[model samples]
Target chain A: MDASKIKQGIHKSKGGLIRSFVTIENGAIKDIDVSGDFFLFPEEAFFKIIKELKGIPAKRGKIQEIIEKTYEKENIQSPGTEPCDFTESIMKALEDT
Target chain B: MNRWRFIDFGLVDIRDMMAMDEAILKGDEGNTFFFWTPKKSIILGYFQKAEVELNLANCKEYTITRRISGGGIAFSDDLGRQINYGVVGTIDNDLFPLDIIGSYKQICGVLIDTLIHYGLNAAFRPINDVVVTPYLNTGTKGARKISGNAQTRWEGKLLQNGTLLLDFDIEEMLRISNIPREKFLDKKIASIREGLTWLDRELGEQRDMEEVKGIMKRKFEERFNVRLKTGKLSEKETALTNSLLPKYYSPEWVFR
Candidate 1:
């Protein structure tokens, strides 16, 4: 039976640095939190997008697609950070804790 | 050429200053540029986890607040005397276009010109920073940081506020803040001072804040091709700021 695990990752965005901690359970994202020194436009949209990540398949492509959908729905402009960076940060967590 | 409303808010609480930024960004009152400074405080970036970035133990004596803008944390001290300016303008405007880095370059160019007016060699580092190269700078490191900027957009407007250090006290800063070691390690500098600078340190003399403000006003007028007509907050802005004040001091906002 797949159990829950927490993982963390960091990425240096063009604008600054961003970090993520994700909780995965049963091959799906149980919860995730993100923080960074990077700039992102429409701060509210960023929150809304991240919230949608819950229950998402704990996979790179799925995470990126969900973030992309949210970005397209809103007029997002993250100068140094791209939507994909969030996925990369989540997936980059090489170790389980 | 355009006319921009300008206000001089000499000194204010950090929470109030941040509230004012949001009030201005959320309003449709055209563009505004305000000169203001905070009393002793620790200002965190929007995305920062305060516990991780700030030394709460040492920060007990300091008031803490967070900015809507995304960037690193900044420490404010009234005695340290920094030239803090806030520019709020419409995103569609040519001066601060929708593009992020481009807008940073264009806006920071005005700041660079201001430093040049005082015979200092200043340059804008990408993302958001206005730096003045130390007179005796050497090696791969060309300049020391004198200013740091952070920006945010609300609706169709943008707010770019930054601080230019008139004087810096690294020891005092380290006491209240926990700057990541990597910041110093990445630069290959012995002490942080080698990578940081201030007006007093560079000029070896004190320049009246008024004189600096006057020069800054001129630079803005020349670079943005706009006249900064002195003004006060609109009734709408005042009320909005008042409404937003309490939230700034709330634990949720400050800790989040």
Candidate 2:
């Protein structure tokens, strides 16, 4: 799968768990949507985490870091899913950008 | 050159105490440490909007008062379950910056050292959380967060406080916060569980709350190497607390 294509799919998935992606284009983030069936806290936790990462110099890297940090701190588990893999996919997307 | 005070007022709600602290901060007169009441409450961050941050209906049902601290929201059930601490004095500007991370660690460090004394594995988590590990017989993974601290910095004085969860009701917490139930059902929520642990769980049934408070006070004194003078709010502080009470209790402040 082309990383960009996967990124585009993630950007379009919007809501309902699994996974989500927000694209950083021209120095601004665009296309924030979720894919897969994953559970997040506080409903606002996702937006809050995302908002906290906004306007950073390395937007993608920051997002990945925050997500992983929150996951580790909150003790969130996604069944058989691996957070590292998810992070790698996002990193791949960023590289393609 | 400073006396560290350890107050035991039982379980006072956050609103009344916050009002008292604010009055002292504004120089309304009396400044003292207090430990009062056995009430349960949730204090919102100073900059947080209560409506957006709390579930009003649940709070009303539970008789919890929102507080005036800036950071994340925390729930405290009673004096036994948690103890609140505040420091009021003219802090040297050069000693600490009035920033979030700076003040947070300073106060939390005291509790961290105290917990370590009990032979409990404790560490400070960023932003403002103290955690213990290995799930007190529940076989849970990750560091269990034992304490959550918040601070209010004004003028040259800093008032930092925290909730030491002797025991926590995780399910109730998820229900009270503005977060949805379904969201916490995911494996993500369990990961969060790993990061938190209660003192009661760690010590089993042999722990003493008063003894813990004494240990904390001793560590605080040792950390700052100051004598903690036992005293009550000055008449000025009481008056200030009373005057500010109406405002802090009003919808404008609570909802805002």
Which candidate leads in DockQ? 1
- lDDT (tens digit, per residue) of candidate 1 on B175-240: 776565545554567766688888888889999888888888888888889999999888999999
Per-residue lDDT over B150-205 for candidate 2, one digit per residue giving the tens place of the 0 to 100 score? 55555566666676777777767766776433333532445445556677778776
Candidates in order have lDDT scores of: 0.81, 0.57
Model 1, residue B226: distance off in Å is: 2.4
Candidate 2 ranges beyond 4 A from true positions: A1-97, B4-6, B28-38, B78-80, B93-100, B134-141, B180-191
RMSD of candidates 1 onward, in order: 3.2, 10.6
DockQ of each: 0.53, 0.04
Query: Interface RMSD in Å per candidate, to 1 decimal?
Result: 1.6, 12.9
